[model samples]
Target: MRLTRPMLALTGAVAVLALSACGAGGDDEAKAPETATGSLEQLAAKAKCDPNMQTDADEIRQAICTTGKDKYILATFATDRGQAEWLSGAKDYGGYYLVGRKWVAVGQEKTVTALQGKLGGTMEEGSEHMNPGGSHNKGGHHS
Candidate 1:
């Protein structure tokens, strides 16, 4: 059968739609607060993520408090490829960290990557990141 112009356009549209669907990321429910500006325990509970709350850095110092303050987790990350060891002199929140929390902190580009991170919480470091959403990377890495 001969393909018509409309058929060709329909095929192209389907291909684009398929690609866009595959590129989608987690929705708002999956995201922790944009800023770790609430009770550390509360945010952790809401996000269901472990809190680190590093001490010593100015921002972390002012942001989180071990002696009963904001309660943000502090995290430091080291990368496998050496794209900056995710170190901040001090950071607040690591496990499912808020933006700018630690080494593998999530941003627009690293949304899924940060969600994948499972480091931080206790004083000790972690081996790799974990997904709090309990979703797996079945298709591939997040865009």
Candidate 2:
């Protein structure tokens, strides 16, 4: 068989279309999977810290756990909207952390890893002051 110019152009166009159709969007355009809420008790059970070390604030639910010599805060939102809000805000705050539909943990790398192992989620690392709202200062000041 002999090659022709039009055929090659058509083939290239088709290839590009096919690749675009099968492509995934960038992170900004990607939608996160809907996450179901787990009971606070379940979260506590998976945490290394005492179940009693928890906060039942209106906006957030959190548990404080200590593993080895590291203490970290494991948190979850009360509603799906809350979860989305927190995830969007926290995604940039680096360090060893895990974010799930119903849970998030922040702490030292090893401590976050141990809890993530028990809880099951993706772990990420980066800077620790990527607050979305610009409310918290690096020096622990909030305004």
Candidate 3:
């Protein structure tokens, strides 16, 4: 075909847009499949826990203070059956964990640790954006 400057530019732009669109939003389910994190969001939303619950941080499903050892264990299943744990204990500070059913709670520590052990994952630490998978860390730093 004949070479045209405008045609080439437009073609390039279109290709870029298409490529960007592919990576636009949400992770791929088929390729990576649904991880435990995906299930947490689903269950929390269903329970009407809070809209703000879904975040890159370990804060509550919302900003509510999860005082007194209370925590939430969001367990997602491949069969669309989501589970939740409104765990409470003895601290005014609580955390949320995006975990799976396979996770087990030892003596102490959030189920995230137990689940992480089962999944061969390190209970994420620090900001969600800092990790490779964008998960919340154990310390639960909302900032």
Colliding residue pairs in candidate 2: 49-65, 94-127, 95-126
Over 22-121, each residue of candidate 3 has an lDDT whose tens digit, in order, gives 2112222223223333344444443333322322222222121121232333322233221122221111122223334432111123333333332332
- Candidate 1 lDDT (Cα, 0 to 1): 0.30
Q: Residue 80, candidate 3: how far off, in angstroms?
A: 14
In angstroms, give how far residue 90 of model 1 lies from its true place.
10
Q: Which scores better on TM-score, 2 or 3? A: 2
Encode model 2's per-residue lDDT on 7-122: one tens digit a residue: 32233233222322232211222233333237666765655456444456665666655444455666766666766555554444434456777676665554555555566666
Give Cα distance to truth, residue 60, candidate 2, Å: 1.7
Please identify which of the two predictions, 1 or 3, would achieve the higher lDDT against the true structure: 1
TM-score of each: 0.22, 0.53, 0.19
**Model 3 regions lying over 4 Å from their true place:** 1-72, 77-93, 96-110, 125-143
Better of 1 and 3 by TM-score: 1
Candidate 2 deviant stretches above 4 angstroms: 1-37, 51-54, 126-143
Those runs of model 1 whose alpha carbons end farther than 4 Å from true positions after fitting are 1-36, 56-143
Candidate ordering by lDDT (highest first): 2, 1, 3
